[model samples]
Target: MKKIFFARPYRFIFFPLAAAAFLSLISFIVMHLWNYLLPGLLHVDMITFWQAMALFVLCKILFGFGGRGKFGGGAPCMRQKMEERLKHMSPEEQQRFKEQFSNRMCHKSGHWGRRDWFGEEAKQEDKKAD
Candidate 1:
């Protein structure tokens, strides 16, 4: 069983099957409890309840395995990879990178610094305006 789980070909099928079984079991217990508590809350018969439970399980499997592209799917994002690389850098390298990034951004946006917004330069401009 462990070997089957570790096998590449079986893994894809195994994960969704396991997830669906787990979810279905939980759903079944919840539904049973709800039925016991309210009896006829939704007027749901056994057949209809089972159908709804199966549908819920199917949706869980599809969204969990298919939606996120986790099961050997989807192209990975470059920005995420770059951010991971940056995070692994030394503290000195990080500070240098941050300085370069801020300088570039400030140059592009024509901002001197955060304090420059309301400091002596802006105060002088305001006095001249008055």
Candidate 2:
């Protein structure tokens, strides 16, 4: 009645085989790239296929498996809740809310751009340091 890539028994067999093949291919690429780049560029030793797989796993653990975008970038429902709250606020309240949000997010110094947190005070500090 329904068309599927693999039937019941084949599904179990096919998925694991596919996953293993994918992992193997990825590890092979990682091994080749590390051998090609890092050994000469960073003077790191060339890694084997198993080592590359381990490195991939280690990176996945250290960073993440990849999901959200950035810090404080919450889920869609959270965004909707924020928008609903903002809609209820007055002009002054909205401005205050925006300022608070900016402060918490990437609007301050050490974030992205050259804009300092203390504005001119940070420039003076930098001059003193220099």
Candidate 3:
């Protein structure tokens, strides 16, 4: 995997500063949005900056923080999963699966016709293709 552009030693120096600025900016925006929209539109109380920060944390907890499976969210994205699977496949199987996957993904007609939506029919079609 690729490391960040700056060197590793510098990341400890830079990351916290960047994260603090990002969190402050996001909190400010959320506070402004809540103040501008909710009170007038729905008669809800306007939120303070601290309230907005709390809301942000709450949302991160309820949903997910990022796509690294940190919050016990569902599986990682498809490309990562496919890459891991490909690492375990033999060379010939990997090549064949890649071509077949590309053809089906590109919606080639013979790769998957209308009848392929049905299980038995699809199996028969696959046998015939082979």
Candidate 4:
């Protein structure tokens, strides 16, 4: 008779054990760095190991999980939607739409020092015309 080996039971135990070990090591590094640097440099109190772990968790919460945001890939999805909409428009309509959008963006405030999308020479010609 052959015996069947079950890998699933081992996987469940291994992953949590690995994660806990990683978190412990990271937290220990955080505690030592904070205790070594901040107290003397910033005149702040040194944190305990648990406090370091909490600080790491707090940072992960406040900033993100290392993507653009919580949901991720926002800009690419928006670009795809815009491309789908543009595909249905005729050439003339697309040109008109692009011109209107470009004009609105160029005239808006707080865009100083950025090169025009049309290029530097076109911008100089526009300045000369004005």
Candidate 5:
């Protein structure tokens, strides 16, 4: 209808042009930075604009750009789902689940925040106090 014609330019031309311009700006900055810094400091050869664009793509593929996921923030959704599932678990089931999860997970100190991993240790201390 009328909407189709109105949106066609945005779908076809405007978005593509905008993407190209933004990518070009990033590539230009990368190119200038490499040209200015590396050749003088490390004796590495300078790269062209297209080469810089390719490098940007390569780094994105290898290291990822760390954007939000399709469902928005990923870990929050996962944690909420986990908590929901855990709420339905029996006491024995919760113990078994905790054992299974803690055994599989080996986090370094200070890596994760505010989680009680050793309730069994506290229970043992209570037995000693009695």
Candidate 6:
């Protein structure tokens, strides 16, 4: 028993167990608060309150603990395709592509600095265009 508990393979069990315990605790606390609030605010009964709590827990389990593609297959093929595409690009084209991709990513991510949005060169170009 001690050896089994200390094994590396058993370490994986701890993660899901801890996660489930934490999620259950959160669900219980949230349901308790909702029960307290709903009875005073809207005159709900204990049965209805418990039913809502069960539904909430069910939804949480379905959405949170459900199997997602992140843990499944097909990721390797997608990564291989991306690597192959990158390997096929010329050095200059790759540099340009990387610059444009980073710029678009930065802008779309909404973490732009002062110069990131519109710099002196961009302003000059805008003025020239006008």
| RMSD of every prediction | 18.6, 18.5, 14.2, 16.9, 14.7, 15.1
Per-residue lDDT of candidate 3, residues 1-130 (tens digit): 3564444668787899999899999999999999998899999998889999999989999986776442335555876798799999999979977766655544546533422333354588889999
lDDT of each: 0.65, 0.80, 0.77, 0.79, 0.79, 0.66
Report the candidate with higher TM-score, 4 versus 6.
Answer: 4
Off by over 4 Å in 5: 1-8, 70-130
Candidate 3 stretches greater than 4 Å from native: 1-8, 68-91, 95-130
The sequence of per-residue lDDT tens digits that candidate 5 reaches over residues 1-130 is 5886776656777788999999999999999999999999999999999999999889999987887654455578788987898999998988888785664444434435333455456568789999
Tell me each candidate's TM-score: 0.30, 0.48, 0.49, 0.48, 0.48, 0.36
* lDDT (Cα, tens digit) per residue for candidate 4, span 4-107: 23634676688899999999999999999999999999999989999999999899899877655534355888878878988999999789667855665556
* Model 2 stretches astray by more than 4 angstroms: 1-7, 69-130
lDDT agreement of model 5 with the native: 0.79
Model 4: lDDT to the true structure: 0.79
Superposed model 6: Cα runs more than 4 Å off:
1-7, 47-53, 61-130
Question: Candidate 6: which pairs clash?
Answer: none
lDDT (C-alpha) at residue 66 in model 3: 70
Off by over 4 Å in 4: 1-6, 68-130
Error of 1 at 82 (Å): 23
Query: Which 10-residue span in candidate 5 carries the lowest summed lDDT?
Result: 106-115
Clashing pairs in 5: none
Query: On a 0 to 100 scale, what is the lDDT of residue 50 in model 4?
Result: 100
| Per-residue alpha-carbon lDDT of candidate 1 for residues 1-130, written as tens digits (9 for 90 to 100) | 6674566677798789998888778778766666676556777554445765776677767877454342334456765775797999999988866666555535444333443323455578799999
Clashes of each: 0, 0, 0, 0, 0, 0
